[model samples]
Target chain A: MQIYLPIAEMSVSVLLILGMGMAVGFVSGLFGIGGGFLMTPLLIFLGIPPAVAVATQSAQIVASSTTSALAAWRRRALDVKLAGVLLIGGLMGTALGVWFFAAARRAGQLELVIVISYVTLFSVIGGLMLKESIKEFWSTRKGAVRPPRRGGQHPAYMRLPLRVRFYRSKIYVSALPVLGLSLSIGFAGAVLGIGGGFILVPALLYLFRVPTAVVVGTSQFQILWTTLAALVLHAVANQAVDAVLALLLIIGGVFGAQFGARAGRNLRADLFRLLLALLILAVGVRFAVELVVRPTEPFSLVVSEMRE
Target chain B: MRFGLALLLCLLAAGPAGAETLVASLSTSQVRITSNYTGSQIVVFGAIERDAQTVARAGPYQVVVTVRGPRQAVTVREKSRTGPVWINGPQQKFVQIPAYLGVFASAPIADIATPGQRGRLRIGLQASVNAPDITMDRGTEDDRFREALARLKIKELLFIEDERGTTFLTPSLFRTPVPLPVTAPPGDYEVDVTLFADGVLLARAGTSFEVIKTGFEQRLAEFSTEWAALYGLGTAAVALLFGWLATVIFRRD
Candidate 1:
């Protein structure tokens, strides 16, 4: 069935949109990722306007992240104190991100900026993940487990001020780096229409040396807030969010997430990481190709209200 | 027999002296874009009244109907390779361009009228709308952008021309269907029907129809424009509520 999206001023197949949401949600569930980066581009490819696609996916992220955050909280895995600090920076970062988004849209540069950022972000993150996961996979083949080290904290972080103690993660460090990291991530997430979990997870685990379990839970908790902030910002600032599109995606996402979470339990961690890393790298490369490649139709149209 | 003569006499009396009389009506006066609206078609039907002397002097008649949507500002951008990546290059900002334009004629437009006549009457798609104002440096490059804009709009089906789109039911009666695509913007649309014979405009009539958003669609558009902040906050709140509800219902022990 075709449904008219009022905000986007377009008609799209309900089944197609549902399928996209379900597929993205399934991947998100299996990987414990927000899936906004995947969903936004897919929506654009399916004919949703780029701005609307980017903004509307933020709402979907809020729902998905909230579900996972609540689950983590119930399991006593979430670091609430850490999430609180992250959100303080997150809100401030979202404000800056939204401003930049609105300005870029007016300048007719939003789409280009989004593509470039995605290309750069996905390549770097995917490359590192692929490298780390492959190392682990090969080590396992030798039938020996390596002793884990819990000492990856950067010495440079000690000089920062506003020291805070996080009981859940058992870390005593300056809040500055945490705030700065989340602020930058939040700004990038809002602009890219993601929860910043992909970046946040690695940053927390590798840079702060936070335990994997706490990192996962805290990342989800913080994503819930940042994506919510982005959703509200895009709506109010750009009026880009489509309620109908968001609703359709949520319906499919909820069901798909259940199946994905179930299937994820049977998958080996090393295999999952390898697959995710490849997927991320693939998306990044696609964007890079789009940038350098000559387009079939070089001209694009932008319709605006007549300003007399 | 007496009534027939009276009708003929009335027709002659109603038509302007030594000229044809054209009367037109649209199938609908308003197009409502509801939540389920995908696209719509409007039929324009009309009758031409002419005296025997005029009919004998002129050849078979041709009817041209045009439907023009509301005017709006637009920006068209062309991309070119800059360094390793392609980016926007020359840009044109048009003050006003019709969101939709459809031209339908009984026969091939070229056969119906001369190029001069076509330009004067703005008959075909190319001549119907004037080139929009360009903001950047005015030169031949701006004209290229203008043509590119028209081409892009044509590709989108927002601007169209169908030479044989109109059909004649009788020598004096004609009708045509003007299709409005799903992307057609909602606003006032003007429909013009012109009758021509021997490369001369015999008569013309004009009417308009409105395309409007209705029901929930209307309310949503209005709210988004009027109360953006509230709408945005509401969207976030509702999304959160939905997420919370899903968590409550779907949570496993």
Candidate 2:
């Protein structure tokens, strides 16, 4: 079916939108990224209003994460207690982010912020990925196995009140750290219109050294709340959420998430990281091009009230 | 047979006084006026040929015009029922529906006076609806107008038809003759004309028009000004807050 979007005045075929959703879902599942980094840009390219695109993406994230989280729980890999602590922090961060968004709107400086942030973040992430991929290629030529970090005592000073053990992750951490992580992910999730799965997964794996099996599950757990909070904030604060568009994307994402989770189980860790690096690089480069090339007319659908 | 001859004799009697052709046309042939409105309006106008028939009836005519468009089209037909209706404000809210004011005719169209020798009536059009005790401010009025235009589904052009004649016009071509009164309620409205023959239903023509508080250019400017600062501060605040929380939660253990 084809539907005409009112704001964009474009005919969007359901099949095309579904295909895009499925493709993003597959990548998200394979690499454990929330897919917002790709989805938002793609929607903008397709002429969806930026605000609507972000809000709708949040709605899709809720569905995608819900499906993925359920599967991870079935595998006995989710650390629910840890996720709870993070969620607490995430909730606070989302509130703060929304406040900041409103302030920026009033100040009339949202676009500059968006452009600068995109360029800086993408360039850094993309450079890192290019470096990692080159290193991997060199390591293959050397034909030497990368040594794993030797087990060592847990660091002090990182300790917080309410220490708890995660049976699934086989680790003990203070609720403070979990709460802090959740807050950070929550803030980022709200601002970027992502579920925070991509960031959370990396934080868990590298910073916390959580086992690979638990990483995806914990990330999904965190993302579920992050996406949900973002969705609610966008709907209430900006009135940007389009329920119909969100429903369509969610329908495609649900099925895709199931397939993605199944495929995720068999993927190699290094290969997954490489794919994530490449995807981030692609997104970063795209944003970079947009920032540098000055268009004759500003590329945007939003009409400002100041012009009148 | 006697009646038929009498009608023919009447026609012959009226045919010779330098007959003028009065051609009437509407901007759109079909319109969808939502029932959520008290009443709606449209515009109907056309050129009169120099040699067409002309009538000397002044403004007042009990005109009944039936407008048919898509069934899903919401016309300005509102009932006095108590229910929740969405109201546009700083924050959109659902309020108990009030008695919606129906359509109002601004001026009993003065007269279909012939233009020079031509039987053309090039007259300005205006209509309004009132909602007493209902605040019809600029914002609300624009919102209602936008909603009506959206319902009109006029992508490129609209066709108008009536007993006088039928005409097609693009939305961009129609011009507003007067400024919209600030007190007007938020509702659908159009410029329209009603035709009457011996005080009976003849034809009606109209076209959808909108009154916007802010033009397109102004909106673009405001968006650009606000977008830059907000996006940056919002992004950083988010990144830092989330980063700190992540550090606190996932410390090395």
What value does the lDDT take at residue A106 in candidate 2? 88
lDDT, residue A263, model 2: 83
**Candidate 2 structure quality by residue, lDDT tens digits, A68-105:** 66667767888887777777888897787778777876
- Chain A fold similarity by TM-score, each prediction: 0.84, 0.84
Whose TM-score is greatest here? 1
Candidate 1: regions farther than 4 A off: A95-115, A150-163, A170-172, A190-194, A261-267, A306-308, B1-18, B52-55, B129-137
Q: Whole-model lDDT, candidate 2?
A: 0.50
Off by over 4 Å in 2: A4-11, A129-137, A153-163, A236-239, A299-308, B1-47, B51-206, B209-253
Quote the positional error of residue A107 for candidate 2 in Å.
4.0
Write one digit per residue (lDDT tens) for candidate 1, span A61-115: 7776676677667778789999998888887887799799999999977878987
Q: What docking grade applies to model 2? A: incorrect
lDDT of 1 by residue, B139-236 (tens): 56766776787798898789999988999999889889999999888889989887877666667788999988889988998898789889888877
lDDT of 1: 0.79
* Distance from true location, Cα of A193 in model 2, Å: 3.6
DockQ of each: 0.52, 0.03
What's model 1's lDDT at A104? Answer: 99
What is candidate 1's CAPRI-style docking category based on DockQ? medium
